[model samples]
Target: MIRFVFAALLSVAAATAQAEVDIQEVTSPGGINAWLVEDHEIPFLALEIRIEGGASLDLAGKRGAANLMTGLLEEGSGEMDARAFQTAREGLAASFGFDNYDDSFSVSARVLTENRDEALALLRAALIDPTFDDDAVERVRAQVLSIIASDEKNPNRIAGAAFDAAAFGDHPYGSSLNGTAESVAALTRDDLITAHRNVLTRDRVYVGAVGDITAQELGVVLDDLLGDLPQSDAPLPEDVPFGLAGGVTVVPFETPQSVAYFGHQGLKRDDEDFFAAYILNTILGGGSFESRLMTEVREKRGLTYGVYTYLVPKDHAEMVIGSVASGNDRIGEAIAVIRDEWARIASDGVTADELSAAKTYLTGAYPLRFDGNAPIADILVGMQMTGLPPDYVINRNDYVNAVTLDEINRVAGELLRPDDLHFVVVGQPAGVENTN
Candidate 1:
C-alpha cells in the first residue's frame, strides 16, 4: 500500500511538471480582452498594451500622423501639461511611457503591487484624456524634424529608408515611421487627434499583465482604466506580399565600413511553415556564434564582426532581411560571400547536423524567455496580436521537433532565391568587387 501511494505521488508530480501555463482570457467589465497570468514571483507587476494595426493605417499624405499621435499621448493629458505629467509620474515613483515602431505602438508600465491602484489610474488618464497641447505639439514637431535631418546624414539610415521605399513602394508600411522632413512639418494637432481616435479603440486593443496580481484584480483595475473607450470592429488589411526589387541599390557613403542588406520576400506570421522557417533561419544566420553566415562571413575572411538575417512579418507586408557591415574595401567581396551562402542554402538546404543543432537551440531557449513577468507579458501580448491560440506556446516545442530535413529543404527552395535579392549597401569598400 505504501509502494502504491509513492508511485501515485510520483505520477502526479510528473504530470504537473509538464502542465501548460494557465493563461486567463480576461474581459474587462468595459469589454476589454486581456491576457492575464498570475505569478507571485516578485512584488512588482508588468502590464503591456498593444494598439493593433499601428502605423499601417496611416492615411495617404499623413505619413507621420500616426507616429506623432502616439508620441503626444503621454506628453500631457487631463489637467496635466507635459512637465506636470512627468513630475506627477516621477513623484508617484511610477514608470510609464509609449513609443511607436514599424508595426505597433506599445505602452509599458512596471510598478510595485502596492502602487497598482494609483499607477493604473494615471495610465488610464493618459490614454483616454490626452490633451495634445498646441505648444507641446510644436515642440515635439521640432524635435522630430531635427531627428529626421540627423537620419539623412546616417549611412545606415539612408540605406534602410531607400530600401523600404524601393521594396514597399506606395504601401503605408513603406513610408518612414518617423515622418519625413516635409511630412512632419505639415502635421497639425488636429491630424494627431484624428489619428489617435481612429486607431486606439478598445476592440482591437490587447492588454497583458503578470506578476504579483490576480486575474480578478487586473480585470477590475483595467476596466476602470480602459472601459469607456469607443469599441471598434475595424477589418484588418489584406496581406501585401513582398516582391524583389529588380536591381541592386547602393547609397554611397565615404565611411571606412559599408553596411549592406540583402534578401527578398519572406513568410507571414501565421504561415504553416513558421517553425520550419524558424529552424532554417537559425542555421542560416539567426544563431549566435554557430550560424553559417557568421562562420563564412566573419570567421573565414575576417570581413565583418557580425552578419545576420531575419524575417519581419507585419499586417501589410512580410520581408526577409539580411544585414552585414564590413570595411569599404572588402564590402563587395562580403556581398559575394553572402550571395554564395544564400544560393547554397536555396539549393542544398541545411544538413542533418545543422538541422539538429537548430532544433535544439530553439527548444533550449524557450524556457529562458519566460524567466520574468515582463518577458511573459510580452509573449502574451505578441500571441494576442498575431491571433495565435492560447495553447500555441505549449505546443511550440512539438512544432520545432516536427520540422524534418525534407520540409526544411522544401521551404528553403520556395522562400529563398539568391538571384532575386534586393541588395542595399552603404559606404565605400576599397578592395571589394562591385556586382551591382
Candidate 2:
C-alpha cells in the first residue's frame, strides 16, 4: 500500500518534470558548484556527484585501486564498522551509492527533507573518511575477485575484453576497470587510500541536486557535504586514437553459440555532426527492432535475435561499436550481413522516411528520461561532465530535430568505415574465417 502511494507520487512528479525543468546553477560558500532543480511537492531530495578521473586515475600497477576504493565506501566510514554504518544509514532512511566508471566516480544520495541533514552527514563521512579496514578490504576484494572469475567464463565479456584490448592498447580503457585477478589481489589498503585521494579530490567534482531544495539550501548542503574534500587536480589518462582495424579475431571456446563485439573509431561527443550521426545510427542499428541491422540479421536471415550499434564517446577516446550473438555456424553470416549494412549505409545513406521517423522517435522519447528526481539529478551531473549547458534539457531534442537529411548523409559518408570494421568473436565450431 505504501509502495503504491510512493509509485503514484513518483508518476505525477515525473509528468511534471517532463513538462519543464528550471535548472539553477549554485555555488556554495566554500566555492563548490552544483546544479539544482527545486520541487517542494514532496519532502524528497536526490543528490548526485561526479568525481572526474575515476578508475582511470589508478596509479601504475594499481589497476583496481579506484574500483576497490569505491566498493569500500559504503562498507564503513569514520568510527563505524560496515554493519554499523549501514544500520545508521537505514535508521535515517537514506540511500547512498558509489560507482566507478572509466572517466568518473559517481556518488548518489536520496533522502527525505526531514532527514537531509542526517543523511548528508553520513554521506560526507563515507566520502571524507572511508575506513578501508582489514575486514572490509578483504571482503570487498574477495567480491571483486569473484566477479573477475565469473567474467572470465562469460563469453560476452571475453569478446568485449578482446575487442577493447585490440582497440585501446595500454590505455586504461584497454582493460577492465576491475583489473586482472592478479592486480586486484595484490592491491593493498594503502592503494585504496591513494585511489580515494586521487579520484575524489574537489578540483574535478561535478554536482547535481534535485527535489525539495532551493539554491540557497543546496548551497549550504554542498559546502557542508563536500568542502573538506581535498582540492587537487587528478591526472587523467592520455588520449589514444582508436587503433583497431578491420579484421576478425576469433577466440576458441567450446560453445554452440558465438558472441561477437565489433566496431572501429567513433566521433567525439562534441563533434559538430554528433546529432546527425546519432540519427543515422538510430536508423542503422540503434538497438530498436526498426534498425537496419535488426531487420536484416534477425528478420531476413534469422541469424541472431538482436544486433545493434552505438556511438561510444568516452572521456579520452570515441568508438562506434556493435554486438551480436548467433549460432557458431551462422555467426559468419551475421558478420557478413552487418558489414554489408555498414557499407550500404555508408554508401547510400538513410532515406527521407527513415530520417523523419528517427527524428520523431528521438524527440518523442527524450522527455521520458526525466522519470524522477534521481534520474534528473543524474542527467544534470552528466550534462556537466559532457559540457552541456543547463538549458540543454529544453533544447536537446531541437538539435536532433534540426539535423537535415543532407547533414546526416554527409556524416554517414564521412563517419561509417566499413573497410575498417573489426569483429571479435568468442566461441568455436563456426563457419567464420579468422582474419587475425
Candidate 3:
C-alpha cells in the first residue's frame, strides 16, 4: 500500500480541477520562484518548467543548437549513457518531456510522491550536468537531419518556411528551429554545451507544480533543481516587424492539394483589447465549424474541408494567421473565398448572436482544459510565462464573458485587415501565381 491511493486521488483531483484551482506563489531559499497547486489528495505530482530564449539563443551560425541540446537533455547526464539514463527513468516509473521552440524551452515531469526526489534528481542531472556524449550527439543529429529532409518535402512546412522568411527576414522567427540540414549536421558538442548554458539559465525560468507538493517542499526542490544553473549572458533577439505584404505567394509544388498559410501583424498578448480580439477571432475564424471562415469557405461553397485563423502573440512579435487546404484545382477558389470573408468581416463585423455564441463556447469549454494535474501544471507555467497573476485561472472566464459586443466589434474593425491579409499557397494551382 505504498502509494496505492494515487489512482483514487486522480479522480478526486479531476473533480477539484473541474471546479477551482488555488495557486500558491512559492519562493525558494535561493530566490527562485515557482507556482504551486498543492493537492495532497494524490500521491502524484507534475512539474512544468519553461525557460525563455529557447532556440532563439542559438548563436548566429548555430540555428539548431538549442533544439539539439534540448533533445540530448535526457539522452544522458553526468556519467550515465543513453541506455543507462533510460533504464533509470523507467525504474522510477516517471515521465519527462523536453521541447524547444522559438520563444521557449519546456521541461515536464511526472512522478509518484515517493519517487519525486529521485526523478527530480534525474531531471536536474539532465538540465545541469548533461554529458552530451559524441555518440549520442551523432545519433540525435542524424534524427534532426532526417526531420529537415522530411520538412523540405512537406508542403505545410514549405509554406510555413516561405511565409516566415518573407515576414521576418533574418530574424530567428524566419527559420525553423530544427535548423537546416547543413547547419544541424555541422553542430558540435561545444555548441550544445553553450546552448544549454544560454537557454537554461535561472533568470528566465518559470515553473509550475501540482499535486502532492507543498510550498515548503517545493521551495527546497526548486533550489536544488534550478539554483545550480548559471545566469544567462546571451541577449534576447531584437523584435522584428511582420515583413510580408498583402497578396498571394504561390509556391509551385507538385501536390494534388494546395496548403496555404495566411496572416498579417496581430495584437500582442498584453494588449488591453486582447480579450476582445480573442472573442472576435472565434466568431471570425477560430471557432471551428461555426466560424465565419468555415461557414463561408466550407459549408456554403464546399471549396475546402477546413479553414481557421488564430492570434499568434509570440514573445517578440505578434501575428494573425490562418490556413486552409484544398485540391489544386479548387485552391484558387478557396483563396478567393477566404479573402472575401476576410474583407467582409473587417468591414461589417459580427452579429449579436455570433458574439453570444462565441462567448458561451469559450467560457464553457475552458474548465475542461483542467482535466488533470499535468494539464493544470502546464496552464500554470503558461500563465507565468504570459505574466498573468495567480488569480488568472479564476478570472480568465470572467474576462471572456465581460467582453461587450461593441468592444469586440470595435476590435474586429481595427484588428482585421483585409488590405494586409496575405496567403502563401503551396501547390500548382490553375489561377494562383507568385505575387510576393
Steric overlap count per candidate = 6, 0, 0
Stretches > 4 Å off in candidate 1: 1-20, 233-238, 429-436
- Give the Cα lDDT of each candidate: 0.79, 0.90, 0.90
In order, what is each prediction's RMSD in angstroms?
7.5, 1.6, 1.7
- Residue 315 in model 1: lDDT: 74
TM-score each candidate. Answer: 0.91, 0.97, 0.97
Clashes of 1: 6
At residue 170, candidate 1 shows an lDDT of 78
Report the lDDT tens digits of candidate 2 across residue range 285-385. 99789999999999998999899899999989999999999998889989999999999999999999999999999998888888889899999999999
Task: Look at candidate 2 and tell me the lDDT of residue 296.
Answer: 98
Q: Point out the worst 10-residue segment of candidate 3 by lDDT.
A: 1-10
Question: What is candidate 3's local distance difference test score?
Answer: 0.90
Question: Which 10-residue span in candidate 2 carries the lowest summed lDDT?
Answer: 1-10
Alpha carbon RMSD to native, model 2: 1.6
Cα lDDT tens digits, model 1, 165-214, are: 77777776666888788888998888887778767777777888877788
Superior by TM-score: candidate 1 or candidate 3? 3
